[model samples]
Target: MALTAFVCGCTGNDRSQPQAVVILGAASTKDLLSDIAEAASNSLDRPVEIEISTGPSHALAQQILSGAPADLYVSANRQWAEAVVDADLAEPAVDWLSNALVVVVPADPTVAVDRLEDLASESVKRVAIAGENVPAGIYAQQALSYYQLWEPLSASGKIIRGHDVRSTLAYAERGEVDAAIVYATDARLTDGVRVIARLDPASHSPIVYSLVRLHGESPAADAVYQFFVGDEARHIAERYGFQAFSVSQDEE
Candidate 1:
């Protein structure tokens, strides 16, 4: 009877353990995290408390490597997750989503900023972009450079800095910036923002999101890891304006 009671107690304790997941994420993933968390909670048979910190990819990576307790990381770019691997903090990075750069204006869409030249006009004075250290900001900078629009745009004194991609989008959505550059994923999050143009995906290095486990691993963490690349999570990703992971992306 003692042995039977002890075994039952252990089983109950195991069943009651909560699945704690911490995501040191980029701002771009904010739109779909709730849906992914819901599916993950169902799979783990425990409530999934996903605490996410949003900032530039580099800053988030440093936070994780510095020993912040994190179950996983979803970065706007693969490089930051790869940083975790270099620090021996996690496994090889996995690309969970593919994204493109986009130019956003106010939801009213009166600017008619349809081309690169349109952006250089004197009327286009202030533009909000992610800070240089941020992934989304870097992409925006690179695209501007490649198209030879950077200098003229910069000379307009309209380049404003957002802490991250989401902040940049917020600037445009709130009528704070005449123009802003953000990921296609960020623009999809709200009806309050409208896209002025869809940037060529090849305009810069591929805009990809990678997932990595932070701290040690566990079944809960693994489920969160898998959820980002699975059909359930992909559905959430699509709804949030990200391209679903191609089967080939899983191998990448």
Candidate 2:
């Protein structure tokens, strides 16, 4: 229950309680970050209590900039990391993982959609996507724009914008929307949603996850960051459908 409690992106943790490390992560990294946090604690000689906040990368960066107490920050894309660094809220960032975008629909034979462009069809009464500034949403817009579908789709008023990728995925999972654009890893994790199409990697900016330490740091927090970028966490991330930062960086 404690671990589950700490996984939320909102500010619900009791501030008075002593915690070893406080990490602010993007929504897509919730499960992966929690797994790494537990594994990193087990590897340490002493137990370290890790608390994580998960949400849109842009929103998380804004929280850190507005003076939220955080030891480590993991963003879903480099632009948000760059924004934090520009504000001098964090140190230089390092790429941690890579992911691809995909279009998802409920696992129903009734849906005849098969490609990203198909989302513009009249049959798709509703489509879920992250809000304008969220990393996943921005990427989704880029890909849709490349296919020249964004403007018309926006005008049609069928777009259902969510605060983050998870929320967007939730809409698809609950059948609130006919389709949603989210990370491939997110689509993989949810059972009710099935990926209908994979967006071409070249269609948009690279979806690189990055980490940065806050202005004030603690040894325990630094240790957790080190463990996160180390081989152990990298292996865990790969198992969860994330790609190596190095492999994707070269392509970028």
Candidate 3:
């Protein structure tokens, strides 16, 4: 009887353990999403362990395409999210947040360059940027093309490409590049880098973040998705310099 009771107790404990909700998100939202996940776990009183994977939005989407097991997908751009939805790996994605881009330099000046045009000056040699496939890079390319600087800058052989926005920011923070184009929220996240100029909204497409619930249909995924779209999550995202996605009050 004692042995049977012990086995039953162990089984019950194993069954009660929290289910993990795997979230694949853009590197830009890492800090904010972690906080939101923690808050949601507490409020819902559900045994949910949020496992997050962060990287360039495009790469994350690719991982999903390759059969990666992700319960939720939050991307820095709708383009990548749309890819996942179009592939039928996820339901239609919903707009979650908005952001803007900025040009940044190391906190300690290597030269007195501060404006977009300064990137063309002799003093600024290498500029760090995300890969063209990443949304930040796409937007940066568009902005530079709009200013008629893209061709010249590309020819100069001073463009340093990073796999993601965070990597580009790292290059700037370490002074590996004279300047970097990154999201404004990324600029705020690090004191090692200083914002020099914000890209005009007209320069490129409006930056929008989107979220989708990947196929799998689990209770844990549903709960986390609900928490993410709730008012509290919006407040947390806004605190991190992201604009809300215009969810109706009733929806909240």
Model 1: lDDT equals: 0.74
lDDT, candidate 3, at 114: 74
True-structure Cα RMSD, model 2:
5.5
Point out where model 3 deviates above 4 Å: 1-15, 248-252
RMSD of each: 7.7, 5.5, 7.3
Better of 1 and 2 by TM-score: 2
Candidate 1 per-residue lDDT, tens place, 159-234, comes to 8999888878888998877788888877877898877788887778898888776658576677667666678788
Candidate 1: list runs displaced more than 4 Å.
1-15, 109-112, 246-252
In order, candidate lDDTs are 0.74, 0.82, 0.84
The C-alpha local distance difference test score for the whole of candidate 3 amounts to 0.84
* Candidate 2 TM-score versus the reference: 0.89
Residue pairs in candidate 2 whose N, alpha carbon or C atoms collide under 3 angstroms: 9-54
Winner by TM-score: 3
**Lowest lDDT 10-mer window, candidate 1?**
1-10
Per residue, candidate 2 scores C-alpha lDDT tens digits across 1-252 of 012225322123333333468888899989999998878876754446888778888888888888888888889999989898899887788888899999999876356778877888888778889999999999999988888889988899988899899999999888888999999999989798888889898888988998887777576677777788778988999999999664233321
